[model samples]
Target: MRPAHGPGGAARAGDLPVLAVLYGRGAATPLGLTDTARGRCAVVFLGDLGDPLVAADLAPVSRTTRVVDTRGLTEAQLCALVVGLAPDGVVTFSDSLLRATAVAAKACGLPFHEPDTADVLVDKFRQRRALASAGVQSTACRLIRSAGDLAPALAATGLPAVIKPRAGCSSTDTCRVDSAEELAARYAEFTDGVTRPRAYVLEEYLVGDPSAVGDFWGDYVSVESVTRDGDTRTVGVTGKLPLAFPFRETGLFVPAELPADLVEQVVRLERRALRALGVREGVTHTEIKFTPGGPRVIEVNGRIGGGISDILKRSSGVDLLAHAVDAALGAFDPPEPVLGLDGSGRRVAFQYLVSPPSDACVPGGDELLDDLYDIPGVDLVDVGITPGWRADWRAGTEWILGTVYGSAPGFAELRITLKAVQDRMASFWSEVEV
Candidate 1:
């Protein structure tokens, strides 16, 4: 990566600080976000009531909270609404709303990624262009909107390249194509039978170091960072469990048991990437992999990583979610992540996602989950799959049936605990009949 490089606010009712959150099916729930801002400030949720995703995104509304419905409002109207709220700060956890939040924040004179930066943040094609233009990365990337574009994209990116929605998240409709024929097929599969074809990005795949990660772990890691007024602090490097199918994440642990040198290397690259992306404030989740050439960036997320807050709180007692709230409020005092603390009896904290096998209906139930609690080192089990539901690989990572949170003394111990859990959990999933 290469180097590259906001606010208004006022107290509202009760003379307390306020955080204006553009809420929907986003990173943190209303309940979860409200909890984070409880003592620090008051939270006002700006709900896009017209969006279908918001119905599931919102937890039950509480009496004390106010949900502002911004559906059918123009961008200027939304900004005016935010200005009227007079919040001390503004923030968003949803990828799709980053730009809208930025616009609103700007209207209210609060700190946030600028609208221009947010544009690049949400659009992969623009981000790649910015990264390469700034010498952060020189990876070849092309945006394709039709079947005719696939052959040229494949020719430019070469075999074993990646094809994913240019502006999508959670790896939905993502695939790896190793040949021109495969690329064409995947392109058709993604575009055919749909009224309007989605734009896609084709880029060279960065190879990972299998030896560096071992069999049970994925070949990548994520650097969780907090940037305040352009001064970024490294929170911690997170390691991953092996991926499911093409690219579904299984497990993630913090205080990633990496050597001091490698950890520093990862942090350095992360800082550069953040700078290249013009991130001046708020929290970021930057994924990187150990390549034979060196550490390379996967992508940079402008919000807290999914399932990361739990592991981070467990590992270091750091409330990353609160950091996002505080950063928006311009009152965040982030602590440098405690490094090399996994020695002696120190433990590694992890969040394990349980995804069902493709083309199967899981026999999941409350009683079936009860057996998971007894596994040593496994702290909590939360599975939402009903007795009969399909799990499709095409559904991507959102196809989660359950999640397992736990801690172990080290990587070796964590592996044993994970295997024990997976082995037992396997019985809950029944293969589909042909």
Candidate 2:
């Protein structure tokens, strides 16, 4: 394979220069991607606001790579900033930024990944329809324009459905309704300018074990490889546990503990869905559910998933971001599956933060960390929440409180370890005062 190169063809693999743009702080996409890229990269942060915590995360890598802050620049101005860097390639974690970056890159005649892939990933309604056509069984969904259309949409798809914005990410603007009355009430919340019609998808709700949520609602389970021509190859499987509610991803464990036969089924379904979506290449984060009969797709994101990739790296020691960067630079080849960390000696768990109710104040940061660290086999604790950051009650779009990570000798031990972690967290929250 040819060495990975920058736009100017000056840098190569083991020495390739890369540029990553992040939309906001706590965005694992660019950070993970940059880590996978090793030290041969630079990062350009684009946003109106900045976070010191995020800057701290990027600080260690500042020695070898440039970190440009362009919070005040317009999109055009940002484009100029990016071009001036003369990066061999540019990558972004936000779909909106991806769209803007793609346009600017194309205008400058620089190589870039397909912009449609970002749309396919960010727009839930469009993603579902595309996957459905590919023979992937997905939730019936429609993009609703106004509250008036909610009734008709419900009539078409049935009740107990999910209402979400078309362009929404991270479960933002998502509502699960059980009745027409509930749907209307939710619609009213949107109508009052509390929620904008940025585009929304109302979907049929599938019932299943919450523990198996990712399997039930995810668009695909098999890890995929896409080419510049839009060809996809299913490589491996990932499993997700249920989020708390409304929107809080709990954790994702790699080498999904599913049976071998079931894993194959998920791979087949994912392949079909990727083809249907016209996804050629790059990383895809697809969620799938395993029904009594077989596996069905929930949704597909044309980019690598947030926590899963991180888990995969910890479990398998293979770097997905580097692979993606190589592919974008036209020097990547499909990789062989590296056997993840052996299950005999250890079990791994990746956790996301979920805040308690708003009326209830969570425990102080130090106390919370202290409790998590008390869990057996605890290895790392990444707390994203700060004093001023908003906290939620019940699971909602803003529920990532903090992550508790650890490993044990086996699954049972791992469960005990994680349970202890949870118990401590619960105790901490319960004891704290608002």
Candidate 3:
């Protein structure tokens, strides 16, 4: 990989800035980013060990790696660690650690989403209230603490409501329950087992534009923007593939092909949503839907869109990971991403590898990896689950067999590349054993 040049273009000798980061999955992505920004790494680990793939990268690049379970510590203790590390900036890309990172960034007086607002961004219930209170046009939502609350919540939101943990990402445990019985059962799974947020949120369902089906557009889109000192700048909007029902994201196509008017409308709605959340600094991923009535906000995340960073890099000539480092250091102010529509424009996408229903038998095995890697236009592949892991379809993103990243000269070509690979994988799935 080529060394990433900083916002200043280059770094002088003895100019290795240090950054303290909260370690999470894909730590290498961020660690490499800091290195490209001409900086050293220091990691704060929540678990006893970091993700193995990331740990390997962290070893050589990180100046100091501490295993501090911030979950057990108070805000002051976490703050002390940040002040003691005394790095130039602090950050974490993990949705699970955004609030902690924001708190530490605040204690260190670094540029990040303000700690108070960060909490609101992490909690969907709070996020909904904030958006609606600010007149941002959001769905009516109810917080559910137990099974007893399900009926009332359901009645309030009507049928086909969305249920999810108050705080989570990757669409984990998110589902659309159409009946009261299914709603109660789903709520029980969370309350009785997962040990997640004490309360889950039930929200009125927002449908997508009826005409979007033929365009292959998902029910919603996300605006990847950066906020600097209370000002927000749009990076690009992403067009999602049909979600894997209930709510699993299959893929994302960047520089979404939307009419000029709709693009402006989305940008304006995103700006209003972010302002309501008080997201004054750092990057944000805001998901919005084009409902029959108008655009409605789905949710806002105070970080970069996870795997879509590659798509952004390819389609817009912007390295969002590197841009994140620039944001942390208070030196980021790049113009909005420039997208092209001609065949000359770059088109990139990421397709998650997921299994069919568990009872379904499938074929192929370790050999499938080779086939995926051999596919043309496939640039990167990461399998979260190893062979013989007993794929469980109910595990949400946890069941992700892997992901394939690829790019092409235009959206049409990109779709061909992705479809070819996906179809090949499907063939293997049909013959493999469960």
Candidate 4:
């Protein structure tokens, strides 16, 4: 196994180390880890590409360290790289990769979280089943491995159902089907590559206002503090605004507009759902809908929610990334909420800078980042666009053009500011060509 270097530029041959496996290069998990430890610890980068910031983030910690770049490697090859790292602990944000890593870690006699819990967190179908059996209010769902299984599943699930991949992220292969014919047509779209057999899930369509709660669970109960055994801290909540079809996220407003009672109810539901899934420790990103009956569970992710965390921290003055890493390292203590702030009643919005379809134009991320930074009270501006990456304007994925965050005095002021910023951004995009 390759030995990583400590913060002092010396080799960590016989010392305990923490391993973080990232699914993609642009993800915020690594950055979160770095912020939490402040380059005082060791880390490993596992992904197709390495972000310059990731290297920059770790450079201050140590000059010489083990970094296993897993780009273009098969699963077995990747496993070999992880084994070579020989880490005492492993951390992952990708659900699929987490499951695989858990198996490998267990076989190598490493103490780690179980894969079944991770599976239940990632696989929407499995999560729904577990929640339903545990008496949690969840949307009706059926797993369909083939077209042969589609009919029975549909009959069991009624009309206006949502069809999506069982383990997919970013709502990549999701579609809403109102009838059997629509389901067949949508199913045909998934007939290639990783989705060929198209192991899909059909769920009863839910309609209502949507919200997200970012929580952390401990050994005994869900709390705001990290436990000795890596229990997590449940922090503030952020309300999500999604686009029309496939439910791609559009914007996020910190500190949801719901009443205090509703917020408590949502928290209780999150605790119940996590307990049922056996997720004792770690961050949870849960999506739900406030229906006519009440709040219903949509899906729960074991890791933190992408992009939303930035807004939560920006508005609430709490760093979720730092807390997550501290919790994972058993050095976390819940900080008191930044209370009596004037920003609570105001709406702080994060709008995605997306390109419109027509010209194959690419966004000038650096320039936009600068513009957002210059804005007064702008909390964070994350540009997810990469050079040479094609932009499908119609694609129902959260490819943030850029995020603009700021607070308004009230809902009316929030609306005006949001529109003004959005219009300014739209004008900027109009001037650019493909």
Candidate 5:
């Protein structure tokens, strides 16, 4: 374990809340939680990524890092480690570790998602069942265990259905099957990389309204929120810039360009769905679609939307990470009143620089970033993949070369600005032989 305050660190952030962050499943850079946390910041990270976050990453943020091999550690053992930290709260950003962290939080007597109910929050099949039981309009779903199980699951979900891992992220191993043959072919393709077979969910397909398709407004949007003691409040809604196939996210535009009334409807469904899932507290990222029948939930995530914390801050003037930690520490008050969707400005957006299909080696990231920074309205450029990395389209947006974030004065201007930057960035990559 590392010291609470690293050498020369501020003597315990005065009276601000101290948080034990189970750092995993987020960007390498420090997040709003680590940045805005007031008191002692202790991080327990699992992995051999030496000095998981380099000093350069932490130069701009405040946190104490403890890299541990948590692979085989029991929830209780992890809790004991966090308990020793004497933290006011224990929380995690990783989807893969949410249940364990919830358990650890419970063992430490901290405010968090209840340990018992946490599983349903991350397990897709269980989520569908819970939402259905609550009369929330989620897709009908069936659990798939093997090839033979697909027929029954397919029957339940219908043709042109969706199939995805019950416990998956980054849209990995997810697909849309339009026919029995396609299901068989894509099932094998989707399941190709499994080391051990896991339960999957075959769900009814949700077709979004085609009319809503525009330059950036895709068929769906994600609702950003924070909850406390069974009551949830909206942070804002984010629109997608048309995801890659098999459901790879491309970008998020905050304060989704929708009529104010429809955004309210989405919020209504989100609150009802969260209540249904028994998400008593913490932050949530719920994706909903503009279906022909109106907005219906696609899925709900019981954490902050990865990579969009800055967007939330830009649009809503609230730090979601700080708010979430504050909720966990039971100091559940917003520094500034959270803005409603209407109040959340329309300019904030984040765009990914995806790996193009061509056999192209992108220009050196340092050079490209310098070019991107020169673009007007480009506020932030995060290079995910460097120039030497080969692009593999078989994977999802995880292959994106980088991400760009910015805001303009209005929706139209923001879109135009992003398009201009994107256009300017188009020629920065050139093909290379394999």
Candidate 6:
């Protein structure tokens, strides 16, 4: 564990409210969170990152930063740490840490999602039951702890079902099962190891309504909300690009292009799901898909959506990370963020992703990031690789090689820019078996 403060991190932040973030692997970069939170309050990035945030990472941000080492800490132990921090609020941008963090927050009497709500938020199977019991939407689901549990899961979820870890993030290890044989085979493969047993949820597959979103857009949209003591205020609905093969996300855009009625339905369903899960206070990202029957919830994540901060900040002048911290502290709304590149002019911003097909060597590495600037409307590009890695289909968006974030004046322009970038990017890779 490293020291909690860097340089002058212990300096007083002018008596501002203290916000302790349970930081780890999740949405929002350490810098992004700090940038948004600069003067609003003092921030303590507390958690086990297994390494200190490099000085380069902390160099730019002003104000005090308390980066504590919290490895090997239990909930009660974490609660003790929180008490020592003496924070006004506790929050996490991580889905995996949501539950334990909630327990710690509650013990400290800090504002956060309570334990029960946090449990449902992180566990897909439990969430499904909660929603169904509350009459939100009932999609058949079964939890499987071992291979022998497959029969009941298959019976309940049926063929063409979706299988995923009960509590996972960014679609990792999530896949669709098409047939009884494939379902059994997948279950066997997933639990192959005499490695410790794992728990997964077999769910009724949600077929996206192509007619609802047409082409180019994903059938699903995530509703972003800021909830305070159970009263949720919706920020907006985000649109997404069509998923890559086997359910990996390809991209996402801001201000989803939904009909007025559809937006109403998505928001209404999100509110119900949140209520059912009992998410009282948090910045949440709930994914709802429009299906043949109607809009249905895919899952409700308690923290900010992965990559949501980038798209939101690019598309609108909103700092979602800042909002999360403020929600934790109470209704501490600052003036609206400066929108767009020009402050007032807004654009159709997007986080376009590129993923390699399974069994293939990943494409161009970090070198190509330089070439990305030539693309029209391109603001930032980050392709995380040096090119020797193999693309595993099950890795989901976490394994995406790179992402391009930028904005266009309108949907048409944004669409054109996206296509051009995708086409240009594909040329960087010569597909080959890994």
Candidate with maximal lDDT: 1
Evaluated at residue 259, the lDDT of candidate 3 is 74
For candidate 6, lDDT tens digit of each residue in 393-425?
A: 777887887788888887778888888887877
- Weakest 10 consecutive residues of candidate 4 by summed lDDT: 214-223
In candidate 2, position 289 carries an lDDT of 60
Better of 2 and 4 by TM-score: 2
Q: Specify the poorest-scoring 10-residue window by lDDT in model 2.
A: 1-10
Q: Show where candidate 2 strays beyond 4 Å.
A: 1-15, 18-35, 39-86, 104-113, 194-196, 209-236, 338-349, 352-354, 357-361, 384-390, 393-397, 431-434
How many residue pairs clash per model? Answer: 4, 27, 5, 1, 0, 0
* Colliding pairs, model 3: 362-431, 362-432, 362-433, 363-431, 363-432
Model 4: how far residue 157 lies from native, Å: 1.7
What is the overall TM-score of model 4 with all chains considered together?
0.76
True-structure Cα RMSD, model 5: 4.3
As for candidate 1, its clashing pairs are 2-136, 7-109, 8-109, 8-110
Superposed Cα deviation of residue 149, candidate 3 (Å)? 1.1
What is the model-wide C-alpha lDDT for candidate 3? 0.70
lDDT of 3 by residue, 1-434 (tens): 12322222242244445556676653225445544455333234432133465455455544433344344566677778677656677777777678778888888888998887989988999888888898887577999887778788888899888898888777777888889888888777766755554778999988778474345557678898887788777878887776665576677777776777888888899999888889899888889888888788888988887666777776667777777777787776665564445455455555544544333544466567667777677877765545555544345665566667776666677667777776877666653443
C-alpha RMSD by candidate, in order: 5.1, 5.0, 5.1, 6.4, 4.3, 3.9
Candidate 4 segments whose C-alpha is farther than 4 A from its true place: 1-17, 22-32, 48-65, 71-88, 104-112, 192-195, 209-232, 337-395, 409-412, 423-434
Candidate 2: C-alpha lDDT: 0.59
Ranking by TM-score: 1, 6, 3, 5, 2, 4
Instruction: Report the C-alpha displacement of residue 301, candidate 1, in angstroms.
Output: 0.9
lDDT of 1 by residue, 171-271 (tens): 78887888888888888888889998879999999888877767677889999888888989888788888787677788898777677888888899888
User: Of the candidates shown, which would achieve the greatest TM-score relative to the real structure?
Assistant: 1
lDDT of each: 0.80, 0.59, 0.70, 0.59, 0.70, 0.79
Candidate 6 weakest ten by summed lDDT: 334-343
lDDT of 2 at 434: 51
- So what's the TM-score on candidate 1? 0.92
